[model samples]
Target chain A: MSTLENGTRRSPAIHAPGEREITFGEAIREAIAEEMARDQRIFLIGEDVAAAGSVFKVLVGLLDEFGPERVIDSPISEAGIAGIGVGAAITGMRPIVDIMFGDFTTLVMDQLINQAAKTHYMSGGKLTVPMVLRTTLGASRRSAAQHSQSLHALFSHIPGLKVAMPATPYDAKGLMKSAIRDDNPVVIFEDKMLYQEKGPVPEEEYTLPLGQADVKRSGEDITIVATSSMVYVALEAAEKLDSIGISAELIDPRTTNPLDTGALIQSAQKTSRALVLDEGYSQYGVTGEIASVIADGAFYYLDAPVKRIGAMNVPVPFSPAMEDLTIPNADFVVETAKSLCG
Target chain B: MSETNDTNPSITDLDAEHWLQAYEQMVMIRTFEETANDLYTSARMPGITHLYIGEEAIAVGICEALRQDDYITSTHRGHGHCLAKGAALDKMFAELLGKEAGYCRGKGGSMHIADQETGNLGANGIVGGSAGIATGAGMSIKLRGTDQVSVCFFGDGALGQGLLYESMNMAQLWKLPVIYVCENNQYGEYTHNSKAAAGSMVGRATGFGVHAQAIDGQDIRTVHATARLVIDRARKGGGPAFLVCNTYRFRGHHVGDIDRPYRTREEEAEWAKRDPLTLLEDWLLKSKQAEEHVLERIKQEVKTAVDDAVAFAEEASFPSESEVDQHVYA
Candidate 1:
C-alpha cells in the first residue's frame, strides 16, 4: 500500500494521514481502541490494562469504556498474556495481548513460536491465529535489562510471525491496525522512546499493510537501513551525513518477517555502499538478514563490505553510561556511514 | 465396586447423550493413535509424530468438560487433544503424510496441529506453551462478554517452566475464564517428575491465587467431575482453576519405541490395569448404559473410521512444491 504522504517528500500538512500530527502513544491507543470498537471480535488483555491502564497508560481510558471484560487487566504474566492471545485468535477472536516490556517476551517464546506462528501451517492452513502482541522496545529511558530491550530482531527471525517496528506515530497507528486485521500472527513493536514523540497521522481509521518496506529517505551516497528505535538514530545520522556532503538513503523495512529485501537490493544497486543499523546485538539479528539480502540479491553492486551497526553484544547494562555504550546511537550510525562512504 | 461420587469419575454432570459423547471422543483418540502407531512403525507415515497412546482419558475428560466452542491449547503430545476437540481424523492423517491435503501441507508435521473453526486453538511442541494461549483465550471471552472458557493441556513437566507460572498469575489475578490442566503422567521425557519439578503443582497454582485440585487421572469419571467443577465456574466468571491429573504413561515416552528404562515393568502393569477405555467399557455394560453388542459395534465404528482416515491420508497428494511459501504470511 502507498504511504499516505508523498513518497520520500515531507511537506507540512494539517490533516494528512501519515503526516497529521499526534503523539505516538495517542496514535497507538487510538489504533487499539478503534479496532476493538470496529470488530466485535477484537479485544485487549495485558498487565495493567484496566484501571491502571498499562504501565505507560497507553491503554488508558480503555477499561472505562469497555469495562473489565474488553479492556481487561491481568497479572504481570507476559507468557500467559501471549499464550492467551494465540488461543483466542485461533478460536475466532482477534486479541491484542500486551507485554508491558520487550524484555519479558522471552518468557513467552513458546506460545509465540510453537503456537501462534505454527498453528496455521501445522493445521494445514485450516487455522489462522489472527492476533497482535503490542509492547515497547527501547533503551533510552534507562529501564535496563529485564525491562528494556529492542528484541524486534528475535520475533522477526521467526518464520510464521510478522514483525512490525514503526519509527513514527503514523506508522504505528497504521501498522497496528494492519496487524490486528492480519490473519497470521503479528508482533507490533513500539519503541518506548517514541511514544511521546509527535508526528502527523490521519484521524480516521486506516491500515498500513504489513510486508511492505518504506524507503524513509532517498539518497545516492549510501543506503542505511535501520529498524524500530534505530530508525530515529538513522535519520539523525542521515541529517549529519548531509552536512558532510554525503547523502544516505534511509530505508525502514517496517515489517521484518516478509522483509523488503527487494527494496534493499534496489537501494544497494543505486548507492553501491550500505550500512545496516539495529538495536539488537549485531550477531544473528535483522541486520544479518539485510546483509544476506544484499549479498544474495545485489552482490556486485556494493562498493564496501556491507556494514552493520547495532547494539553491542552484551546484556543491557543498568547504568546509563553503560547502556549508552551498549546501544547504537545516532553518532555511531553516522560514523559508520561516513567510514563506509570513504 | 463401591466408588464414591467424589472418587474422580470423569463425566459427572452430563446426561446419557453427553456421556456417550465423551465416550465417543475418548474412542476417537484411542483408535486414531493405536492405528496410527501401527502405521508409523511400518513406515507408512512420513513425518514423525508423538503418539497419545496411553493418555486418552486426560484429553477426553478435560475436553468433555468444555463447551463445543471453548478453546483448548494442547502440548506436543497433542494428537489425543486434537481428536477429542473434533479435528477430522482424515485431515490429521493427511497432515502426517505431509500431503497437499494435509493440515499444514505437512509443513507443521505432528508438533503443531490446529483447527480454528472447532475452537481447537492448537497443539504446541514447546513445553508449557499453551498456558499463555489459554490465558489469552480466557481474556478474549471475558472481553466479548461471552462465558466461553479456555483449556490449556500441558504436561506436568510444563509445571517447571517459567511460562506456566506467568500464565497462572495472570489467569488467577483477573479471574479470567481459563482452565490449566496439568496432565502429570509421571515423566518429562526421560527425567522423573521428582527430578524435574521443584514444588507441588497445586501449591504453585495456589500461590498465584488460583483454585487448584489434585485428581485421579486414571479414573476418567473422576477427572470429568473435578474438571467440570472448575470449567463450569470459569464459564460463569468464577475465574481460573488448576487441575493436576495424576496419571501415568502406560507406554514409552513416544510411539512403539519403548526404549526408555526409566520406569519398571511393574509400574507399567499398574497403570495398564487402570486403562480408561477398559474401565469405561466395563461400566457401560455393567451399568446398562450400553450393551456388549453395542460396545462391539462402537469399536467397529472407530476401527472403520481409522481405516477410512488412513485411506484418505494415503490417497491425498503432497503439497505442491510452491506451497512452502504459500502460508508463510497472512
Candidate 2:
C-alpha cells in the first residue's frame, strides 16, 4: 500500500494483461464498495439510496452487499442529511451523504457552509469532519431550473470545502476513494451526463490525490484549462484546433480547492496563452477564477489575454434547444480557442 | 437518587450527594452567566454573549441525566449548556475573551464553543442550525451500535424552523437515539413565540410519531426526572423524544440591546418570582434537602471559581495572527 501526501493509503495497482473498462457510474459504485469494505466506519445515507439503489441506479446492489445498516434511505431533507453527515463524521464515522442533485445544495447550504465546513476550525482543530457529500452536476436532462445546475463552482468558492469534479471513470474511482479518506469535508460533483460514458480503469486498488491537475492532452500553441464535463468538450475542441494547425493543451485541475495553480500557470507559461472553460455560469464562476489565476501567474509570458468560456449566465431552461445553447460546448471552446490563438 | 420507575421523580427522592451536586451545577451556571455578563458590559470580553441567566434549570436538569460520552448540540445562548455538560469555566471564559487558552483557541468565541472530550458537537450560531447535526449524531450512535444518546438543545424560537421537524421525522422513522430539548423561553429574540409559532410545540413532534412531552423548565427536579426518563428510553432504542421546557429568559436578547419595550416589567417580575435558581433554593429549603448554610457555601464556591475563571481568561494570551488561517481545513 502506498500513502498519499494527505495521509491516505492507496493499494498498489496490479496491471492485468488488458485493463478493465467500466462506465462512470459503475466505477463510482466500485470505489464506494471498495472503500466501504476496507473501512467498517464508512456508510452511505441519502434519499432512495437503499432499496431504490438511488434514483440514478448508481448505488445498485450496495444495500444488498452492505446490508440496510450500512446503506440508509433518508427522508426528503437535505439540510438534515448534510448536517447529520457532519455530526457523524466528527464523531468517529466517515459518512458519504448523497445529495441527489447539485441544485438541491441550496437546501443544504447552512449545514454544509456553516456547520460541516466550520466545525473543525471552530473547534480549534480539536475536531475534524471526515465526510464526502456526493452529488450530480449537469444540465440537459430536460430537468428545469430547480433540477439542473452546475453548482460545483459555488461549493468551490467556500473556504473549507474541497470540490472535486471527476471527468472520467478512472479519476472518479480514484478521487472517490481519496475523498472518503480525507480528514476534511469534500464535496464531489459528478456530471449526470457522463454516468454512461466508458473509460479504462485498473482492476487493482489505486487512488488519485486531489488538487493534482491531469494533462488530458498536451500541445504548444494555447493552453485550455477545463473541469468536469467540460474536459471532454475541451478535448474535442483540442482535436478541432489541431485540424486548424492550432495545438491546444488540456489541463483538468481535478479538485478546485487546494487547486494546482502551479500546473495551470506552468502550462500557460509554456503555451503563452490560456482559455479557461467550465459548465457553471460565466458570471463569477469557476472559469473566471481559473482565468484570473492564469492571467496573474503567466502575465509576462502570455501573447494574448487569458480568456474564459462558461455556461451562459441564465437559469437552466427545460427546452432542449435553450438548454443546449446555455451549456458550454466543444464548438464554443474551439471558437474561443481560435479567437485567443489568432 | 432513589430508584423509581414512576414518572415525575421529585426532589425529595434525590440523594444528598447528587442533590448537592445538582445545586452546585445550577449555581455554577448562574455565576458563570453573571460573570460573563459583567465581562461583556465592562468591555472585558471581545464579543457579545447571550446570557443564560433565567433558564438554568433546563440545562442543569437535562445535562444531569447525561453521561460524559453522550452527545449534545447546543445553541448561540449556550454557556449554561456547556457548563452543565462539563466544560471548564476557564476555557469558556477564555473563548469569550478570544484567548488562546479558550475551548476553540479563540476562534469560536461565545456562539461556537465545542468540546469533543465531553461529546459536545459545538454550539451553533444559526437558529435551529444544530437540529440536523444532533440527529446525525443519533444516526451515528445507531450505526455504531452504541447506547449513547444525542441531545439537541434549541430555544422556543427554533420552532419556526423546518429543519427541526425534518430531523424529528427521520429520527422517529429510523428509531434513532435522540432527544430534542426545546427550552421554550417564550421568545424568539425580541419577538414573542406566540406570534412566531403556531399550534402546540409538542404536537409538532407528535405529528412525526415521536414520543413527546412538555415539562416545567423552572423545576429542576421535574426537568431532571423527565430528562432521565427520556434519555434512558432513547439509549435503549425507544427512538427520539421531543421535550418542551416551558421557561423564560431574564435578560435582553443580547448584551448590546438593553431597551425593553417588547416586554413589560410586570412580566419580567412574574417570571423572576419563579426564577429557576430561586425555585430550586426554595425547594431545597422547604423539602429540607439541605441546610441554608450548605447552599450558601455552594454559591460562595461557585462565585470563587467563576472569579478565578475570569482571571484566567484575562491572563491568557490571544491567539497569534498566523492562526487565523489555521484549521480552516483539518
Say which candidate scores most in DockQ. Answer: 2
Reference-based TM-score of each model = 0.87, 0.96
The alpha-carbon lDDT assigned to residue A234 of candidate 1 equals 79
In candidate 2, position A297 carries an lDDT of 94
lDDT of 2: 0.89
DockQ of 2: 0.81
Q: Taking the candidates one at a time, how many backbone clashes does each contain?
A: 27, 0
For all the predictions, what are the DockQ values? 0.61, 0.81
TM-score (C-alpha) between model 2 and the true structure: 0.96
Query: lDDT per residue, candidate 2, B77-113, as tens digits?
Result: 9999999999999999999999999999999999999
On residues A11-77, what C-alpha lDDT tens digit does candidate 1 reach at each position? 1122345445677788898988888888888878777788897888787888887766677776676
* Cα-based lDDT at residue B177, candidate 1: 87
